[model samples]
Target: MVNSVPDCDFTADYLTATEADNLLAHCLTALPWQQEDILLFGRTVAQPRLQVWMGEPDAVYRYSGTDFVPVPWDAQIRALCTRLARDCGTRFNSVLCNLYQHGQHSMGWHADDEPELGPEPVIASLSLGHARRFVLRPRAKGNPDRHEWSLGHGDLLVMRGQTQQHWLHGIPKTRRAVGPRVNLTFRRLLGAEVSAGRAESAEIDVG
Candidate 1:
């Protein structure tokens, strides 16, 4: 099965454990990580985890009132991007990397449906480090169905089609003592003058 959520897929063994370990080490110390404070629930608060945005110079991304400029892609990252692009049959101009230090550092529910991302964007996520619970909830009312996945090291998950519009996904906090985990979400951003192409959507649009 591609995914528990419609229009998505998960590869449990995308990379070898040894390869994952090396990449984890390189990312942990090589990349410049930052924690940004964002407006949440009418109050500004620091994000629980550290993150970095890397991509093409023109690929600017903004979220929660914070505008992010792209950092030049590292050599290792560029290589991975090339491989993923070839494998997925799509180009990704940017990647948002999030480092979860422990179980307490988590991400809240959110979709990747940004204007710059255009409609029906394909997102590729690579997981490295400890295992954690990633949850997806159907946005349609009365369905009340939710799906959860245990994302571990060297795994890859792809979300495509109208999944973003119809589902909300996040990494919730856990009480268990867990090691650090890193997530790289690759996305293709549309230029200001560009228009989105037509594509099919999921059965529901919760928002």
Candidate 2:
């Protein structure tokens, strides 16, 4: 079941409609959503969507050359993490929350291949609210392989094994009118440590 797509797993209905609706509403108001500045092509630009990092205190994540300290876990998110750990068979310790306010709020192509994730990281992504298109392509140039999915409410997509080592994924900006959506990606950091120095730029994105 976990190998539905070459190191990826897609569960169409991980959460019931009622559960998704309630979770989405809670996240919209309960979580502290904020736009962050990211380094891109030698320039600092605001990330297109609002995001919050939540997890254990030691799970400091570095993305797009920025080190983010995890916020204290809320009861709701902790419960969800427990459920995902059991169901996905991975002890996830952190979650990145992304809020896409509309069609214009999108993520660019990037791999979740940070050093803290270790080799062959397992990432479980749960989607709620409006449906959106997710695209994946091989990192190797000129590769013809590509995959796409319409991740709607209650869907759970898990990427594990060597997926991050070989593929880049993103949510492209859409012109069609769309409502708000939330995505929670749960992961386990391997010996995460806080760093003193900061870099200027690197490829990073949330999905």
Clashes of each: 1, 0
TM-scores, all candidates, are 0.89, 0.91
Worst 10 residues of 1 by lDDT: 198-207
Task: Name the Cα RMSD for model 2.
Answer: 3.4
Cα displacement (angstroms), candidate 1, residue 55, comes to 0.6
Q: How many backbone clashes does candidate 1 have?
A: 1
lDDT of 1 by residue, 1-207 (tens): 223465888999788988888889999999999997765545567888899999999887556656778889988888889988998899999899999998888887777877778779999999999998888887676767888789999999999998888888889888999999999999899872232222221111221
Off by over 4 Å in 1: 1-4, 192-207
Every model: Cα RMSD to truth: 5.4, 3.4
* TM value for model 1: 0.89
